[model samples]
Target chain A: MTLNASRQRLLGPDSLKPLNEGFEVIGAFNPGAVRVDKETVLLVRVAEKPLAVRSGFVGLPRVVSGGSVSVDWTPEVELDLRDKRVVRRKADGIARLTSLSHLRVFRRREGGSGWTPGPALLPETSAEEYGIEDPRITTIDGLHWITYVAVSRHGAATALASTTDFVAFERHGVIFPPENKDVVLFPRMIEGMHVALHRPTTRTDFCRPEIWLARSPDLLHWGQHQPILCGLNPWESERVGAGPPPIQVDEGWLVIYHGCGPSQGSEEVGAYCAGAALLDLNDPTRIVSRSVQPTMRPAVEFERNGFVPNVVFPTGLIDHGARLSVYYGAADTAVGLADLSRDELLSSLN
Target chain B: MTLNASRQRLLGPDSLKPLNEGFEVIGAFNPGAVRVDKETVLLVRVAEKPLAVRSGFVGLPRVVSGGSVSVDWTPEVELDLRDKRVVRRKADGIARLTSLSHLRVFRRREGGSGWTPGPALLPETSAEEYGIEDPRITTIDGLHWITYVAVSRHGAATALASTTDFVAFERHGVIFPPENKDVVLFPRMIEGMHVALHRPTTRTDFCRPEIWLARSPDLLHWGQHQPILCGLNPWESERVGAGPPPIQVDEGWLVIYHGCGPSQGSEEVGAYCAGAALLDLNDPTRIVSRSVQPTMRPAVEFERNGFVPNVVFPTGLIDHGARLSVYYGAADTAVGLADLSRDELLSSLN
Candidate 1:
């Protein structure tokens, strides 16, 4: 409720008109940001479903059915892809995801005319057998480091890759193992060590989902796993995952993340909101303060009706002198901007 | 320990020598008992694996593979069933029951020399696709009404049947739907309605495994599904299942059931223990008192080392004046008996 309901819309799924014409765009949100050469760059996660009207079958076109752009369902199969986030095939009674997601960049110079779409970065390695989604960028020295979720047969893993001019990228492979995702790296090195915050989802062995921190000299090799945040309140009883890269301030590094709780209806639906936490600048793992309640929730119509309902996912944020622009995914559909005072956010932290 | 550890052993696998000559009796425990014509009769659950062990193959024989005697694994295919209890097929990657379990009658007079083995109650209908296990008998008037767990392709359901002289049993088919087991019928109708306790294991929609109570106008039809007992303490966090039939007492129905918690090693290995509870005579769902602590845990060496590690599964209990004889499966391998005072059990229930 602290976030302003009235604000100008930023870059959304409609910005990529060329890609939207050829494909059925599901959502374009959760953009990872990095201010490169005075220009703000966003690596947005774009999801798409196959478009079929005349044919009585399920699958992507032959051109996009394999490799990096793989179709989850086979041809001549009656499958339900109603859930835009995932294309599920129920051949043997249980639904399994068969959709691929790729990252698309949106660049905007401080005072430039709106935003411009970059090339759609497809998966290159076998590790990304399914696809990559939800990129979080951290620029160290001169290189722009992007961490994203790589989904494959092995499992959902956090992958690392770097770029210089947003044109040429170097893949550093998977930094964190499977059954773990929602990784955000600290923009600057703390004590010459790269610190990261990630979420590990354990379905059987452990009962609850926990947020952990890991430090490494090299971005590819991570170690020293320690839990810094967890599901303490009923709002986050289900899970708490790290959001965008931490923002540096005079007090500390402020972080906004997403927390999910079980919905009153069915397991398919969940209540997702954005929460804030403050971490020490010298040691990113040391949590200084945290918000007992969520800063922004699903309060508007757009945030209540989409691929996933009741979701206000914060992915990118920018701070002005008096106002803060929190770029979030509204209901997992469109990109939204919420404004808050700089002092208000700093004071909200417990 | 509230119950004495020592007692004269009644019936184990040794009594079924004739059947043991050809078949392998893995476990002979969790017996359901009743007093008929001054003689105590037990419907025991006998689980058996394959006897042909010379080769490196695993399966069950034809005698125990079908009918009331059912084997979980199909013998035609080469499958790995090393887990003893479950048969896991690598094709679909699903685990099924490896050991075939069926109900067998073991009778003994008030002062008989030893226990004698009776007929093996073979599954006569298709509903008993897998096998019947863990029966609890309720004798109303002259008829002995028995309720047991029926496993089939449809799923594990609560089945109802009746017997008179332990020779002839009339199958009333399945009374409860799938995904439910551990059924125990009350001794008599409370205000003209038969009350029963059952456990239903939910897969996805619901999380916890809880024990439910239902009332029936007729034995064939049951309704009024309500959760009577659930996991309250950490020791019984995994699940709580109904064990022996609710014994009628002046205080209330003295109920002895089994509660399972995560083992010290892994979540796969659970420690099963016995606990007591008191229910209102008029309404079985209205719990009068429940024991905060377990009465009997997997303490003895016999109860610790069996087919399943650290399990003390109580299924049969006989009230003898001031003394109560508790028959339970020792370590999921054999039947072990313990004696407890009637006053001690009532005092244990809070």
Candidate 2:
């Protein structure tokens, strides 16, 4: 615990009720940002769906002609049942793993949170036949733009949409296409173009996922793929992705990203946290400084237990000079807030 | 499934073994390097100790005060009961966990194939109160050095040792005083100094476990701390630690590390896997590439089960030109092999 900060339940369990009912309001892992009416807001990727059934797994249970159940052989997908190398899910389905069909958002209204729920953003494309997840919202000039993961059989692809207010969003179609997520745009104009951070997933032996800097004159079409950050280090030796929008720190542009490590057991997916890296304000890809550790984690029950556990996603950040407030989703269930000083975050990175 | 090129073994109850002698072998995570002969090897951190009686645990049972065998709330520590985490024989004082008694060689002699046994290194060390576990071996010039997690009641610390042969070893004083593991040395010397990767656990508002780079002229003394990688990704955002010895590629040096994501109910940890990163050969601290998905995971039964299951630790890597023969310990039990071509590993990092 190098970070000795007090924990506060800024948004406790069931704080954003009614609107958040029947669904989990979790941080989108990578939160997107957009500015409208002079106030900064977040496009939080909130996942909400029905619980799934797992009893019908291949080897866990043998179904007879009459629908009787008996143990025969173990299932291949049930990799967690036999070994401790992977995380195992409850076959009964009583235990909630994650589902696809749903996603929503949480906006900061009137400079404060816990306001009346705004408009709900749902998936509108076929690529997200399963559902859309992990939205990264960025605004250019007056137009609000969002890039999200559209999930279907083809896997997760990046899609784009725009909105002026929390309500009335105009679909901008799929911006980056499939196998991509974690898209964040730089505020203002860079060389008279929109610069965004995007990670495209490709199939390779090493599974290398890197953050690329892309520029777009219009919010829809992106060009000039420049490498911003690569996932090749001891801390994030495996996979690296982005989180939230890059905050304007004095030294440079501070962007929070996510890095991955290996798992310990069957079917168990590891956790995600917040890490910060400073990019050149003008270039937006050059590295200045980065946090060596995460800003937050899934330590509480709501964070450690749920459909998918050990997950603290930072979908948005609000910088208030000395204080920085971060709104994140926990355990794929509810939204939570964690605050720290700008000085504290910068000092801790060293 | 891309690694289906190697020999695959389930090695469950169906496979032959020293019956009832099954156990788990977790990665000390990132182990220290020890150069022996013309080869570089990793001193893997292994924790195989005899099981202790569970008398006070919440879910465990105990004997009653009466002579009869009744469920008791509180029992003696000396009494042996069902302990899931430890692998020991209560009847005899012998234990499998690191005792200053043994060290298994990653490179064994002939006839050392499937279900074969190899000789241990030095059976004893003056500094090892509980023996060495999870060793990270590195080679600088011709000298081979190993930094490992040495444990005693005083708490765990990183200890350095030098070895030229798989049989003999020379102990260097503790490189890191205490509360440290996941140490990897840069393959090449940087600025006439030895660069190493390490993580010192500290308590922060969020659990701050990060990978750091340190410089040392002498392998034992470390200075010039630089923050290289951060665990801010969604997959491994919880706590990121180092994994295997770094592999040198054309683009950069590749280091595989382990990360713990969000936890599940009743379980504080989740899945562990092998993730790769490319770093500057000269700087050693600058990251070049990273992976978004895991290269090797707990996909098989042996890789998924065991003492404290769900762990796949790759401590030894033998590069045979086109293929990388990765010898890994599955679920802390036995050794298994997987192969990935140099092309695949490099391409995945893109």
Top model number, TM-score: 1
DockQ, per model, reads 0.01, 0.01
Query: Where is the poorest 10-residue window by lDDT in model 2 chain B?
Result: B13-22
| lDDT tens digits by residue: candidate 2, A69-169 | 22333344643343221123444211112333334444554656453345667654544544567776665566666767765333354677777776787
- Poorest stretch of ten by lDDT in candidate 1 chain B: B62-71
lDDT of 2 by residue, B1-350 (tens): 12343535422222322111222222322223333444434344344332333445312211123311112222335334333442233443222222121345543333334332233443233334444666656666666667666543223456777766546777765565334567767666767877778765431111235676766665655544444666655556655667656777767777767665555565535666666678887777777877677677677776676644666666556556677766555665545666777678767774
Assess each prediction's global lDDT (C-alpha) against the native.
0.70, 0.54
- Candidate 1 deviant stretches above 4 angstroms: A1-350, B5-8, B18-22, B54-56, B60-83
Clashes of 2: 99
Whole-structure CA lDDT of model 2:
0.54
